[model samples]
Target: MKISLQINASPYQHQAADSAWHFIQAAILSGHDICRVFFYHDGVFNALRDSRPPGDERDVVKRWSELHAKHGVDLVVCVSSAQRRGLLEQTVAKKLGGYQSALADGFRIAGLGLLMEALIDADRHITFGD
Candidate 1:
């Protein structure tokens, strides 16, 4: 099955991101394909490159990056949402004279059209959080 995920909550503050990650891992292990992961609202925080969780805790951002690296999953953060939350992409940050290294590896900033396309193309479109 080709599955796509939409996350709307921030990591640590809610269980949605953690649940989504575990689901993605299980699905991939079961021979399923993760087409994309669309991060919206506070979910965009998951892609922050400088996120530094404590050594005792799981690094959600790093886990997402590793997942993308290993499985070739498309991790996309909503552009408008990201901007609203101060999570700028490299080009946008550079143009705006903001921090140019905002997003983590394997994650890209895109519009809602990408989410819509993923929904249309995937066998299942699962949403976490609000």
Candidate 2:
């Protein structure tokens, strides 16, 4: 099955991000395809490049990056949401003289069109958090 995921919560603030990550791993193991993961609202924090958790704890952002690297999953952060939360795309940040590398590896900032496309193309569209 082709599954698309949308996460609307922050990594540490709620269990939604963790649950979604585990679900994606299990789905891939079961031979399912992850079409895309759309990060909206506070979920955009998961794509922050400089998010540094303790070495003993799980690095949520890195996990998402590795998922994209290993499985070719699309990790998309909502452009408006990110910008609102001060997480700008590299080019936009550079233009504004802000942090240029705000997003982590393998994640891209885009408008809701990509999210709509994923929803339209995937067999299942699963949302985590509010």
lDDT of 1 by residue, 16-123 (tens): 999999999899899999999999999999999999989998999999999999889999999999999888888888888956769999999999999999989999
RMSD of 1: 0.8
Model 2 TM-score relative to the real fold: 0.98
**TM-score of decoy 1:** 0.97
The digit string of per-residue lDDT tens for model 2 on 1-130 reads 9999999999999999999999999999999999999999999999989999999999999999999999999999999999899998879998999667799999999999999999899999999988
Model 1, which residues run further than 4 Å from truth?
none
Candidates in order, TM-scores: namely: 0.97, 0.98
In candidate 2 the C-alpha lDDT for residue 38 amounts to: 98
| Model 1 lDDT, full chain set | 0.94
Q: For each candidate, what is the lDDT?
A: 0.94, 0.95
Candidate 2 Cα errors over 4 Å, as ranges:
none
The candidate scoring highest on lDDT is: 2
